[model samples]
Target: MNKLYQSYLGSFTGLRKEIWLLSLITLINRAGTMVIPFLSLYLTKSLDFSLEQVGWILSFFGLGSVTGSWIGGWLTDKIGHYRTMAISLIGSSLFFVLLQVPDTFWTICLGIYLVMCVADMFRPAVFVAISAYSKPQNRTRSVTLIRLAINLGFSAGPAVGGLIIAHIGYGGLFWVDGITCLIAGLLLLKLLHPKKSVEEVEAPITSSQSAFSDRSYLLFIFTMILFGFIFVQYFSTMPLFYAEVHQLDEFHIGLLMGLNGLIIFLFEMPLIKYLENTKLSALMNVILGFLLCGISFLLLNLTGWIGILIVGMLFLTIGEMIAFPFSNTFALSRSDGKKKGSYMALYSIAFSISHIFGHNSGMHLIGNFGFAFTWYIMLGLAIIGILLLLILRKKLEKETIEISR
Candidate 1:
């Protein structure tokens, strides 16, 4: 038992202290991420807004995320990741406080846009910082560590958020969210040290001028969009499926969602550590991940039993464990360190696009066709995604070898 504990601890060895600190910062910020997840409910119940108004407000937030991601990348290259992150955290916190004031439709919509725009700008900076702080070999592990922290916080946030909502209401959620962001920003500002020289912080001339100019990265981005389009259905359609098909209550649905985080937290780091230098390439793992995700959904069609849902979710969780972190590592490997922000920003945009495309497409399919057809469509996309990914793997392997050389 002691040896097992020691080995688990050993997996975290050789990571820079900054990476651990960053993970803590992420945990602090994400733990209070109450407002966005429950935004629609708050709008409908507390502010007395209609469903249409809520949709427009949430849509504006999504637009803000897309815009913020691009601008964050641009700024990270020109400024430094540390400063960009500090600005994003502090600036976004102020906006969240302002978000509490507006009750009218246009006013609240504008507030949501501004809040998301500032809040989301931290993402690219965080990705760039992870690359900057860790050695190349340890990069994937570092990214996974932060993701683990995020999942932990995600598991905690809603439960704590529910309590606050019950007793203190919507305004309490905003206050807690804003305060936590402020604390995270202040801690990050005090700890993260960038080089003093301008030359050290800026991108080199040889780095790709823009992410769009690189054809291989563009193909990579396309693959990401395809996978993201399917994977994101977990957030949008999966819950509806659980409620409608399985006849699960809200508490049961929460338990199933919690299971994803629990499994990832327990297994992902060790799994990545085991796989790190193996014969299994990152590309193959990603393909397998997608395959498993599609299979998980298809498993739903095979049975009406709730146990099948748990089994399927376990597969989906494992797929996420393999795919998401390595995808970031692959992107970081392909990018010049100085221009990493831009490359990662493009990657982040794929997810943002997925948020819009995936949910709408799932709802449309389910509405027009049926639940079974929707799973079938996802299965078909996953198969196609695997084929494109095979082509992408060659370019990625070539690029990785070049980087090593």
Candidate 2:
């Protein structure tokens, strides 16, 4: 037990104190993440929205996210990460509160889109902050630590949010989520004071390179978009499928969803530590992650048993753990300090636009063919993502070797 404790402690030894505090902030913020998880249920049951309506409304949210990420990256480069993050967090909180206003369908839909746009602007800023604060050697673990904090908060949120929705209602969920975001923004202000002048963290041939002109980064983004298309279905469609097919209640569904967070919180740090110390490359980890995620969905078709759902969630959780952190490190490794924010913002579009392709398509598929067909389609996409990621990895490796020479 003593040796085991030491090993775990050692894994996180060299990470900066600022990163730890950032992780704490993420944990607090995500703990209140009650809105999105239950949004589908609220729309269908409470608003009496058709599947098509729900799909379009959610796709609008993604549209807003796409705009937000672009603006956030540009802001991070111009104004600096600290200010960008602060504004995004505080602005998003206000929007969440406004979202609770009683309104018509078009009004509510517009509100949802605006809320996501303000909130998602924080994504690129956070990535820039993480890269600025971390050592290149420790970058992967640093990113993983942030994710671990998010999952820890997520583990608590859904389970508690489930209870809140069941007893207090969806309005309560929005209010609590807003309050938490405000508090997190305040904490960021207190803890992290940005340097007056952004320090150049890495030297590059040119700081003026546009991400639009970078062919390698573009290919990587394309690969990420494919992966994102498969992954976002967990948020967009999986909850609906569970409710419809499995007949699970809100609390039970929350418990199952929370299970994904719990698994990541418990295992991701140590797993990343072990892998980083091995010969396994980021690209290979990505390939395996995609394969596992695909298989998780495929498992759904194989069993109607609830027991299989846990196994499936386990695979999905592990896949997220491996793919997401490494993907961040890989992108950062390819970028220099000057272009980091731009690179991260572009990277974020993979997830932002995926909300459209993944959710809208999944909903359409389920509406017509049923849940089995949706999983089958996701499985096929994951396989394609794996191949694309593999090719990207090889090209990236070649580029790095040439740069070294």
Candidate 3:
């Protein structure tokens, strides 16, 4: 038992101090991520918006995210990751605060779009920063560590946000979210100065191809967009499912959502460690992750029992744990020094695109066909994603062989 405990602890060793600090910043930023999780609910219940209105608002959020990601990548490549990240953090905080003022449908939609545009700029920049900070071999673990921080923060965020909403109101959530982002941004500036923290580690140059020109990578990105389309339902639609279908309150829904983060926080690192030791390729692991995600949604259809929510959440959490870090690693590996931000930006953009379509489509599906049909649709999308990933793997293999010759 002692040996097992030590082995689990050992998984986190050898990561750089900068990576840890970055994770800390991410934790702070994501800990206040109360808004996104409850946005649909806020629109539907608080503002009394129609489901269609809510869907359109969320799509605007995605549009802003897409804009932010593109700009962030451009800034990272032109200016640097440090400045890009700082700007994103501080700039987005102000917009988040502005979100509190907008009560009408169009106003709320515009507000969300602006906030996400500034907020999501942080995504590509952070990915570039992670690549710069970590050793090549340890990249996956480094990404996992960051994800751990995110999930850990998310574990606390929802429960607290739920309580705040219950007692104080949605206004309080915006204040808290904005404050945290400001704090994180300032903390980042103070601690990780550009000269000291943004040091790039030595890594072999694999490909200098622009992300735009990489056909296989583009296919991979498309697959990820599909995956994001399906996976994002957790944040956008699943909360509504809990409220309407299971008749859960905000607090109970928060607890269940928090459970997903808690599970990932506890198990993901050790699971990642175990996977890293195996001969399985990253793409294969991603495919496996997709399979689990599909099964998770399918599990919801199998039973009306509330316990199945927990069970399905477990599957989804595990799938997320497997998919995200490896995807980061794969994307990072495909680029070299100057192109890193562009590659990661496109990667971020894929999800941003997913958000535009995923949330609105999901809400429409639920409103029209019902949650069971939505879950089945999600499962079908996941299957399609898996098939696309498999094709990408084959193309990647062919490219590798040709390169070797």
Candidate 4:
């Protein structure tokens, strides 16, 4: 048992202090992430919006995410990741508070769009920061460390958020979210001093090619969009499922949602370290991850028992653990120094685009057909994503062989 504990601890060794600081910042920011998880619920219950209307508002959120990612990427390259991240954190915090001012439908939609525009700018900048802070050999582990912080914060956020909502109401969520963002920004400024921390480590530039010109990478992005589309349902529609179908309340729903993050926080880093040592290709791991996610949804369809929800969440969490870090490493591997920001931006944009359709479409499917049908659709989409990834793997291998010749 002692040896096992030590082995697990070994996985986190050798990561730079800056990476740890960055992870701390992410934890602070995400721990207050009470709003997004509960956005659909607030819209439906508090404001009494229809699911369809909620879907449209979420789509606007996605649109803003796409815009933010583009601008963030551009700024990261232009002004550097430090400035970009600082601007995003401080700017988005103000917007989060402003979002509560708009109560009506159109105003709410516009509010969400604007909030996400400034908020999501943090994504690409952070990725660049991670790359700058870690060496190539340990990069994936660094990413996992950051993810662990994210999931840990997520685990705490929802449980606390549910309590906040129960006692004070959804209004409290926005204030907390905004305050946390402000704190994270200030912490970043103080702890991660730009002159000392920025550009500490430099990844090698293998190619000068633009991310848009990379066909195989584009295919990989498409696969990520599909995976994200299915995976994001956990946050959006799955909560509604718990409420309407399983008859769970907000507190229990928060507990269940928090389960995904808690599981990831406990197991993901060691799992990723284990996978990194194996001969399995990153793409192959990603394909397996997709399959597990699909099966997770299929498990939901297989039974009406509440235990099945936990079982399904376990599957989804494990799939997330396996897929996300490796996919991030793969994207970084394809990038060169000059366009690293652009490549990571495109990657962030893929998930952002998925948010646009994933939430709305799932809500529409559930509203029209029902949850069972939505699960089946999610499974089918995951299958399609797996197949696309398989194709991408073959193409990547062919390109490698041709280059060797």
Worst 10 residues of 2 by lDDT: 196-205
What's the C-alpha lDDT at position 389 in model 4? 95
**Residue-level lDDT tens digits of model 1 in 1-405:** 999888888888998888989999998988878676566557766898754555456566666777788888888888878888999998887888778998899988788778877888888888988877887778899999999988777667766676777777778888888998999999887876675223223334474567788888888788888888888777656766776788865446656766787788888898899888688887788888888888988998998877999998888899889998888887887786337778888988877676556756776677678789999999898899899989988876797799999
The digit string of per-residue lDDT tens for model 2 on 1-405 reads 999888988888899888898898888888987888888888888888888788888888788888899989989888988899899889989999889884567887799889888888899988988887887788899999999999998888999999998899888999998999999999999987786323355444376777878887898788788788888888778998888889889999999999999989988999999989889888788788889999999999998898888899999999999999988888887677447778889988778988766677778888999999989999998988888877877887798899899
lDDT of model 3, residue 332: 88
Q: Candidate 2: where are CA atoms >4 Å away?
A: 196-199, 202-205, 397-405
Per-residue lDDT over 2-53 for candidate 3, one digit per residue giving the tens place of the 0 to 100 score: 9999998999999988899999999999999898899999999999999988
Task: Sort by lDDT, best first.
Answer: 4, 3, 2, 1
Clashes of each: 0, 0, 0, 0
Tell me each candidate's TM-score.
0.88, 0.96, 0.98, 0.98
Clashes (candidate 2): 0
Q: Which tens-of-lDDT digit does each residue in 146-172 have in candidate 4?
A: 999999999999999999999999999
Residue 285 error, candidate 3, Å: 0.8
What is the Cα-based lDDT of residue 207 in candidate 3? Answer: 58
Error of 3 at 390 (Å): 1.0
